[model samples]
Target: MNTPYKNAKLHDCRDAFTATLEALAGQNSDIVAVCNDSVGSSKLGNFREQFPERLINVGIAEQNMVGVGAGLANGGKIPFVCAAAPFLTGRALEQIKADVAYSQTNVKLVGISSGMAYGELGPTHHSIEDFAWIRALPNVPVIAPADRAETAAAIRWAAQYEGGCFLRLSRVGVPDLLPDDHVFELGKANMLRDGHDVTLIANGVLTHRAMIAAALLEARGISARVLNMASVRPIDEAAIIDAAHATGAIVTCEEHTIFGGLGSAVAEVVVDHAPVPMTRLGVPGVFAHTASANTLLDDFGMAPDAIAQSAEALIGRKG
Candidate 1:
């Protein structure tokens, strides 16, 4: 556990993502970046300036961008395909499945401003369904890092790993939670704070909120364990089972939907392994209204206090 993250400075995971990519490219000449003309949003401006020839902007054609990434990987060059989450996952899902997942290419799919990060841009821009869309496919490890440190680590891990991966990133600023030397481990959940009353599991932007919710529960004499579960697919089944048996109850909070996202993935593990009283907090099964990213999350009842309340309620149903 790092220092109590109260009032810590905020950081966008994309900045750390691009910075790590640049540093990795410095050492490996086979690394290349393919994007749907998202240089500014993907934070690849510096990378474009550093490696002018290596940055391939495939205009607004997301499908073509993914195909090009696959081709680059086929040629033994590592390709980080960057684009808005909605377009990258929604528009080019077919290409992602056939070219990257089925072919098992070494392509890094970076979904910039995922979840409700583009909330003000309406539901069309919101990429909340990405978890279900990509998690359904094989040969693709779905990951969403909780902080900049974890973001950098996951990026580095994807660079060295052999197969395809989906790194879901948010543009919304969040305080760092993990230590500076934190390493990216696939299918492993990091327990931020331990408790026996109820477990709060979350990742990406919701991990910090889970920490705060844990503190709030503690203040009320309820012990809440906090788990930063960055990997959605290849989920930490052992940790989820342990949390269920140890805590007796669990509450999953995520920026995506409760239907088929982090919460759904965790529930699938819990249902098969160890059944527990679980409440998934996120955008319910409805299109979200236009609002700021944080405002939409709060509106959908994923605020820290709301999460703590959900955890407390779930504990009551434990049998």
Candidate 2:
């Protein structure tokens, strides 16, 4: 069967995130954007221009920015602490642990340019460690929306969802992989294409790659399941188990380290519930050399063809 979302308009999920944040802020006076001098990169220019009072630029201090966000949350304001993913999650990790997660504050950590979005900018800028970092913390739901529609839905859901949450956004453009009005349900994986041979699981930018990989598998007479799994922390255990039982083999692709990211998340579920033959496609644990984000993904064997090849290889190991 053909996928519901085949060829669609490509869009940067960050644009949808900013647009939704601005609209939500207009509705709720308590909604505010706090960034570490990343208004332009985070694409909050229009937001800053519209409501200057609501947009707080903390000027390159990620730690202080998160601290301020926690303070604002304590004062009954919904603060979206936005910054580059590496700095926001890596630099202010302690703040995220103590003030936001441990304190149980209602602050939304908006990680802009997450994953390899800063590809070619070097390892210091890439946020390949974000998932492992944030997922290790308690009381924070780590989310990476699949596309623009899911990004908007996840933002809206985060606004209404009380307590702390991390919304991982990317500047890299991706084709619309979900329906126009898809709603994000926490811990639920959206099955884009179903097959009995093997399964391809991914989130964020890799979701589109997984879909393309599934198409390639179909061309070779091997049916492959495609899953858009955005919620990494509260992973969809049921779907993971079902995929294991149905497909007998699984392939996970992510724009993150193969050690402890989306692939690890899915593997945990499969290992605990139903152990199945699985292959993970991602950057090996190594500081990447200078290359564009897309180039890095392709280099690390996460390109669509690479993912499909991984899936094809995994099928041979299936019982």
In candidate 2, the residue pairs with backbone N, CA or C atoms under 3 Å apart (3 or more residues apart, or in different chains) clash, namely 120-291
- TM-score of every candidate: 0.98, 0.97
Candidate 2 lDDT over 77-103, as tens digits, reads 999999999999999999999999999
Please, what are the lDDT tens digits per residue for candidate 1 over residues 1-319? 1224545888999999999999999999999999988999999999999999999999999999999999999999999999999999999999999999999999999999999999788999999999999999999999999999999999999999999999999999899889988999999999999999999999999899899888888889999999999999999999999999999998998999788999899999999999989999988989999799988988888888888888878888988
* Steric clashes per prediction: 0, 1
What local lDDT score does residue 115 receive in model 2, on the 0 to 100 scale? 89
Worst 10 residues of 1 by lDDT: 1-10
Error (Å) of candidate 1 at residue 206 is 0.3
> What C-alpha lDDT do the candidate models reach, one value each?
0.93, 0.91
Cα displacement (angstroms), candidate 1, residue 275, comes to: 0.6
